[model samples]
Structure formats: C-alpha cells, structure tokens
Target: MTATKRCIRAEDLYQIRYTSDPQLSPNGKSVAFVETMIDEQRQYRNHLVLQSLDSKDLTSLTVGAVRDTFPRWSPDGATISFVSNRSGTPQIWLIDAKGGEARQLTRCKTGVSNPIWSPDGKHIVFSSMLSPEDSFSDVEGESKKEVQKVIVVNRMKYKSDDHGYIYDKSKQIAIVNVESGEMRAISEGPYNHTVGAWSPDGEWLAITANRAENPDKQHSIDVYLVPFSGGEWKKVTKSKGTFFFPTWSPDGKKLALIGSESDTHLHAAQKRVWVYNLENDEQTCITAEWDVQVGDSTIGDVRSPGHPNPGAVWREDGKGMYFIASERGNSGIYHTTLDGQITQIVGGSRNVYGFSLHEKAQKLIMVVSDTASPGDLVEVDLDTKEEQRLTDVNHDLFAELELPAVEEIEFEAEDGWKLHGWLMKPVGYQQGQKYPMVLQIHGGPHSMYGNTYFHEFQVLAAKGYAVLYTNPRGSFGYGERFVQACCGDYGGNDYLDLMSAVKYACNHFDFVDETRLGVTGGSYGGLMTNWIVGQSNQFKAAVTDRSICNWLSFYGVSDIGYYFTAEEIMANPFNNPEKMWHHSPLRLAANIETPLLIMHGEQDHRCPIEQAEQLYIALRYHDKAPVSFIRFPGASHELSRSGDPQQRVLRLEYTADWFESYLLTAEKASV
Candidate 1:
C-alpha cells in the first residue's frame, strides 16, 4: 500500500512564516533577519534573529508580542538597532548582537522608520511622522493614543493605500545618538524627506522628496543631499521624472539610482537604473539600453511589509553595481558597469527579493523564493555567483503538506509576442480524470507572476482545481515596451492575451475541463477577470477581488486614480468620459453570464471598495447571474496576503468554495 500526503489547505496560511530584512554584520561573520508569523492570539509578531557564519549558531535578539524590524548593524557589529512597537509605539530599539535584553533607543511621539547607522556608528538617521503644522523636532510628550476622529481632506493626495491617512503628516529626517539616546531632527521642512544612504565621509545623506513648488500637482520626485550637521539640502539628480533610492558607492563619488524620466509619458515610463557623479554633477543612464525594468516587480500571494524592496548595491571599486531586475518572468540580480555593460550575476528562474553584500568578507546573503517555497535565506558567492541555501525556515511546514507541482508554460500570441506563465496541477491528480481549471491573473499589469510561491494557488489545488496564471504583454519581466504596451490598451490586446492562453491550455492540457472553466484575480488582475466574465460567456465562474468596474469613477475615488486612469486607460475622465466608460468593465457587468463573487477590503484605497459596490450593484440589475459580495473590515488592498490572519483565511476559503461550488456543484446540478 502506498501512503498519501496531506494536501495544503486554506488554513495553511497561518502556518507559513515570512523572513525578511537580512542585514549582515560589519565583519560579515553574522546576519540579522526578521521572521514574522501569526501568533496564537491571531495577531502578527516580528522578532529579530541572529545567525553566525562561523559556528552556524542562531539566536533570537528580541521576542514576544511586538514587531522588531529594519535591523541594522553597528560599525563594530556590537549592537543592532531596530524599530519596534513593544513599548506601545514604534521607536528605535537597540540590542547587543551577542544576545541580551533590548534597550529603547528613541521614544519619539511620531513613529520612526528606516533606521540607518552612521559610518562612525555614533548616530542613527531615521525618518519619523510629523504633522504639517508641527516643527521638525516636535518632541513634546504628546499622547501616542490621540485618535484622528475627523479627517479634513484638502489636498488631492489625502489618502493612500499604503499609509491610509497621512495627508496632514510629513516624514522628516531625524538623527539619534547611539550612546546617550539624544535625538534631534536634521532635515526639517514641510515636505517629506525619505532617507536613502549616507556618504562614506558621513557628511552628506542622500534623500528623495517632492519639494516642488506645487508638490501635489507634480508627479515626479527629486533627489537631494542634506548635510549631517544640519544645512541646506542640495538637489542632486534633478531628473525629469520620479527617481529615488540612492545607493552610494564605496568611494562616495557616484550614486546609483532607480527611476524613470517623468518629463513625458509619466504613466508609461519604465524604471531604469542611473548613476549620478558628485564631481561633475552629471548623471548617466546605466540600464537604459538594457530594455528591462529595474527592481523586483514580481507578484505573489505573500505581501511584504512596507520596507522598501532591495535595490542596487554599489561595487566596492565604484566601477559597477549589483541590482535586481524583472526579466522574462523572473527577478534576477544583475551586474551593471558604469560603462553601460550589463551581465546577469545570479541568473535563474527564481525571485531574489532581498540581498546583503560584504566586500571584505566576500560574503553575500540572498532572500530567495521559487515555485515550491515561500522564501529562504541563502548565501551567494560574490565572485563566482554561486548560491548556497542557508536557512530552511518553512521546511517543517512544507514537510507536512503535499504541494502541487508548478510548471512553466510559454506560447506565442497572434501578434508574435511570446507570453510566459506557470501552471499548478490539482493535488492528488488522477492519470485519466479531468479537473476544473481556474485562470489566475496578477495585478500591476506591470507586475509579473513569476517564481514566487503563491498560497492562493495552493489552496485552489488542494480543492482539486488546476490554476493557470500568465504574464501578459503589459506585465513586467519581459521588457519596458512589453509593460508599456498595456498602458493605453487596457482590455484590448491584454484581454486577448489572457484568452489565448486559456484556449491553449484547454487544447494542450487534457487535465483541464473546458466547459467548467473559472477565473479570478486581484487588482488589475481583478479588472481583467471582470472584463473576461463580462465579455465572454465561456467562463462559468468568476471572482474579482479589489477590482475596478468603472474607470470613470475610479479616476476620482482611488488614491492614484486621477493619474493612473489617465496613464493606464489613456483617457482623462474629465476630457473623455465616454472613452473611460467604454473601457470600464461596469459597461459589461450586466452582461456577465457566469456566477460571480465580489471580494473587497473596506479600507482598500488603491482600488477603493466603492468599485466593488458599483460592480455588485451593476450585476444586481440583471440578477440572472448569482452574485455575492464579501467585505473585509479594517483590511487594506492587501487583504489576501498580509491582512488579518482570520480574514486572510476567510478570503481564501470564500474564493475556493465559490469556485468549487460553482465549477463542480453547479455543473452537476445542470446535469
């Protein structure tokens, strides 16, 4: 008798743990990373973990009901500074890398973020929230529990999906002395100042902010260098578009930047890497000819914390740098020389989400993920580019579960464009039996569905449904032009690309049941799902999560709707209402013949929940197609990934049940 393995269920979400922000020690002998998991109380806990390379010993720096993140090593590696809410509000906390009780570093009223140790290791530079009316160093002991009972929205950028309601607040740079715990604001102004990197000399700090005359109307951000001793900020890379995240070279002569030209086509512009020289005050586009978008733009079921994604790391020699780019369905680390030569350093069909490098020790640590794994820490050889798996954080959870095998598929569209995607087979599949297939679409139309492990896909496979997901032309990983292709052509060719993949799968894969097809996606993927079900009756079931049905209204309600609607659909609602409505899925929602499920987060500001209300109401007018709406309270657009643990599970349960009940039970009922 053969033993069968238990398939992964929706409840497995709680069992999955997320590890990130891996910071190598100054001596490169140890690494400090944050591991986040759902606690017994149904809340999330983040703890700092330290592991030594010599003895292979791992230790927890901090533990218990709190979030300890953004760990940074001191110059001597004696202490580690992190931001934690253990004391009721998030502030800088310090702990010995050797393991001991953590001591609070800063007790600022406004929460602190992105702690960076100075070169001398005497001071730490961080940004904290401050009201527009408050001065830069407003450290008056105001109660942290002051609730904003009423929100007065004056600016166009009043609310955002990331920070919710921070219109009245600005993020200003502040410095905290390590020894005495004395803190003072460095760069103080009405505008926000995001810390990027410190000069090797410790005299200058690179930051980006929108300090324009009319910051709200301006779409681009400027990179500026502020003095550590408190002086006037100097505008560095005065690029036409929004460029940030300045990585300083070892010699501090040049700075590596990732941004796009915002002077024109702000919406369709692609993120490219550039190098700005301090001596001549000139910037060179390093990755412009590479034709790929910079940074890790891969989409998955797991949503990382608000920490900025890992960017370019300057070489010690200052001649080149190592950066991550989305290329052909995978986010790979590549090496780019100042002379415009590019080489793939750690190239593969894998997602390298985060990495840390130490030149003197010749050591490199990478946080990697693929189809079979959520994420794990690995050591990558700097010279040979060889990788060694260092941590198996999810090995125990994965050992007890049977995960469906994920395979990559590729086919050429009618327009001769090669499309890339992956397919997850139903768990415990029979050789000759067919199963219902669900077409999964990813958001970002600019983001690619690549090597990352998706918990949502596993849940569907556990329910005996094959999941098919693809990166259409508009998706990243392919190239700049491919991503921009979907800009003005919302549902035009991108919709066809999805349908062609579905047709190809049904014809080539005998395991898929053509008549019992289902489709689901979130964000832009959700919009595509709504479009698919509305335009085609071929889909028997559809689930749209945090989707937009009416682009005309989406232009006003969404955080970035005003610009995104114009850039994405190429139609300003004010100038072209007819065109915006024409591209909107709401125009076809009443024509949807498939049973639909509208899933949304009430606090979703990206694609506001109002979009869901409009979608459900439009479908209600017909009432022919069975439709239902589920709202997750206090959940943002990331409800599927990092929302409340219970709510996340409920989302997966609802999505899986709706597809199973309709694709199978409804199919049998008709028989």
Candidate 2:
C-alpha cells in the first residue's frame, strides 16, 4: 500500500526553493530569471536560470552561494545584465545569453541595484548609495580593523530598520558601459535617487527623486529626467505627492507611473496609475475610478529577497499598458488605456507579484503564487488569459506534503461593514471534531491577508489547529475608504472588526472551539493582539512579534515613528498625549489574563526591541498572566520574512510550541 502524505513542518522551509524576477528575452523566445534556495550553511544561495520558451530546457547561467538577481536582458538579447555580490558586495555583472563566464561591470565601493539596460543596450544604468565626495571609481579596499565611533545624528531619518544609519551616503544613479568597463554618474547629490525607465531613443533616463531643500520633512517624491550626456535634471511632476516606477511610452511622448497624491497618510493612500504627457505637461490619474490599488500589494513570506515590482509594461502600440492590481483578496494583471478605460487581462485568486511583457508574442511571463503554492513562473496569453505553468521549483517537496486549503469567508463587521477573511482547518481534520483556532493578524494594518502561501499559517494548521486570518478595515484590496478606515481608530473599530470576525468564525464553523482560542500577529497585528488580550480574555494564548506596546514611546523610538504615529493615530505625544495613551496597548497591561509569548528582533529599528522589553516588564510588574519574551539576535523587522533561514524556521517552531503549550490538551500536545 502507498504511504500517506505527511503534514508540512517548519523544517520544510529548507526544502522549498523560490524563483523570481522573470525576464523575457527581446525575441520573446527565452526567459532568464533568478532561483534561490537555502544551502547547508543556512545561508541564501541565488543564481540566474535561463530557459527556452519552446523547449522548456533550463540552464543555470551563474552559479554561486552568493546572490545573483535583478536580471535584465540587453536590447538585442545577446547578453543579460544582473547584480551579484560574489566579489564581496553587490555590483553589476554581464553574461552572454547562451553561455560563458560572466564579467563584472561596475567597481563601485557602494553596492548597486535596480540595474536596467539603456535602449541601445550599450550601457546599463543602476542606482547606488555613495558619499558626497565619492565617485564610481573610488573603490578603496577597507581595512579589517574594529573601532567604535560616536554616532552623530543631524537628520530626523538617521536610523532605519535594516540600514542602521543613513546620514553619510545618498542614493545616486550611474551608468556603466558594457565594453569599456567605464562608469559615470548621471545624477548626484546628498539626496536619494532611483533609476526609472530609459527613453526609447536612449537620450534621456527617467528617475525618481526629491530634490526639495528639506526632503526629510516632505512627502513629495516626484519624477525627473536626466539626459544621457549628463546635465541638469528636468522635473516632470509638480511634486505634489509620491510618484515612482516611471515607464516611458513607445512614442516617448508619455510616461506611465504608479503612485499616490496623498502626502500625509501615504500608507492609507491608494496606489493609483498616472500618466504624464510630456508634450502638454498634463498629469492625470488613470486608475482613479477603478477602485483598486495599482501594483501588487499582496503580502506573502515565501519568496526570496529580490522581487522588483515591474511598474507599467507599455504595449508595443503604446495605446495602453499592463500593470498589476489588487482587489478583494487577489492581485491580478490589469490593462488600462491612456483615455482611462480599464480591463482585466488576467484575474484569479492568486498574487501576481512580478511580470515581464513580451510585446512581439502578445504574452507576459508572471511570477504567481497562491495558497498551497509557493510561487512559479507562468506564461499568460494576453488576449485569451490562458496560462501555462513554466517552472516548478518546489513541486517535489509539495507533492510529499498535505497542505491545507483556505476557505474564503465573507462576514459583516459589528458596524455593518462587510469584511473578508480566510479559514484553514487543521490538517487531517475530521468532521464534528473540536479544534483550537488561532487568529492570525497581519502587520501594516494597511497590508492585506490575501490568497497567498504563508508558511506560518501552514505550520499552525499542521499542528492540528485551525488557522484564521482576515483583511480587516485597514487592509488593502477593499477600496480606499475601507483601507483608510482603521488609521485614526487604532484599537477602536479595527479592534471590533477583528473580534467580530472571530465571533463569526466560531458561530459559523462547527469545528472551532470557542473556549480554546488563541491570537497572534506582528507589528500592527502585534499591537492589535496586545489590544485584544487586554480588552477581554476571549483568547487563551497569544503571540505578538515586533509589536508596539506604548504609543508615546513608539512615536519617538521607531524609524518612521515621528510621522507614522502622528498620521496613523491622528495624534502625537506633544499635541495629544491623552489620546496616545488611551490608544496604547500598554495602558491595558493589567487586564491581560492570557498566556503570552512576545518575539522581537534585537536590531528592529522600525518597532524597536525596547517595545518588547517594555511589554515583558509591564506584564510581569502587573502580575497578570504568564508572559515570555524571545529576542532574535542581530535580526531586524524583516526577521519573519527575510531574516536568517534558520531563525525563520525557529520562529515558526516557537510559535507552534507556544500555541500548543497553552491551547492544546496534554494528550494532543504529546501527540
């Protein structure tokens, strides 16, 4: 007899392989992409993989334990430009499409990223952070000496999450010649600059920057263009809001961009598609009435580090362009005309994270993922919407495991607002059997819990527990008003929305045991988890990661605390201390009666580790329920998503262990 498939375990993370950044060749006959996996050392290994569209033959173009990503095909498709760190730091590298040894192109001390070829393919443009006095050729080898220097902070945005300090270096755009191996800066200043699209004629390159005198205090990031010969930059937008990912039209008369006009509450602002007419200098929002956020906003943790959003893929005829959009729970490909008409090119219950267009073939190669599927490259016919699976990086591993299927749930909140969510029954579940349910909340509060593969949820389901996740009022994909509704009302209506969903799930689902309930989330979700346990002891166990306990402290400590707290909560410590304290989860610490497990990254500047420390001490000081804290050394806010592979696995194991300890019976816990 054949053996039954085993349930997915936390260690299955090592067996899973991720593929991203699919780049279709100029002729639309082949594809070059990046494949990533964890090696024996628990470090990430990425390489370029080339495959023919017709034969489906796969070949690795570059091989190393180091990262090789952001593959961009040259104009003639003869060579591919990619970013690699084999020599110590990331730099642009070129390799022939067919095969051969790759050649390093840039020698900048600072690493480069977002590498794109000029229209003529003679030069590759990339962005890098460099000191004001440093040039592309200032490649001085560093001395292996350890020293401690006092950190001087003059800017409000000095410390960030992953990149600790940002006062010394600024992002600049530069170009490197493929043949001469020479590099020159196109735009330079003590300001951040990002590479956009190159004009079809290769005369100008569109860039995203904020050259305002006080950019640190402003939210206006506009588009600009610099000539190939390198001179003054001509501002394209009026600097009214945040704009980026500018793509030039085929005729070079227009530029399609994805951004928002809101300056203050950008996190709640809807990402819309806009068009700029260079001839008349008119800017219009094309996706204004679409009621969908442009670009892929679906949140998932399965993919590798390098997933670039391929902004707007202009059609060959230049009448319209293809872009990714999110609505409800799925993010799909959409097409819009210059006149504002829109159509769905590809719609599904999945997340189209990235895609590349092949104008000649009338097809697009997309990196797509859904619940139960990590992600894979898919070829879709634009007209018919017919999809063909291209690569299966984790097919073998998935075939041996039994993954839970998500059941979409639509229920009304307490205030009559309809909310969307998903429920996953325990693995090997039987009808009429009671099971402990864990409510999983997503961070970003602005981000959505969509139909994407989340390993953490799968691990909980495998532990014989039902997993419930929902996109509450503050989540994307539900229109602008719904997403913005939870901003000012932190633990108010958003709290009610989550509790209503849990109540709905328990009332509707027969297998859910209301008495044995648990809650967990990270960041904003963590804040909400803290809020939920304090408001009522409906939950028996809770796990909060990278959470915020005190709003007053977070307003001063977090990287974006200065602006985020003011904008999201509609109050600051100086102006409205009482409101901030009233909304803070720390104020309700004495009411927490559930067993809690707090997890945080030591290096998390976004939601500093001090937030966790404060909460742990407060709970113990109040002598409430049991509380435990776990600090991941050297990890950042991205610990759960892109931290060390081993730590990510451990996080899952710890979460499951915590939930099991509190919610499960001794008989089931032992099993």
| Number of the top lDDT candidate | 2
What are the RMSDs of all candidates, in order? 1.9, 1.7
Q: Clash pairs of candidate 2?
A: none
lDDT of 2 at 288: 85
Global lDDT scores for all candidate models: 0.84, 0.88
Which residue runs of candidate 1 sit more than 4 Å off their true CA positions?
1-4, 135-141, 144-151, 265-268, 666-671
Candidate 1 per-residue C-alpha lDDT over 222-336 given as tens digits, one digit per residue, 9 for 90 to 100: 8999889887878986647988789898998888888987665564567888888899999889887888878888777764746456567887888888878888778877888
Score every model by TM-score.
0.97, 0.98
Off by over 4 Å in 2: 143-148, 666-671
> 245-284, model 2: which lDDT tens digit per residue?
9999999999999999887776888999899999999899
In model 1, the Cα lDDT at residue 178 comes to 89
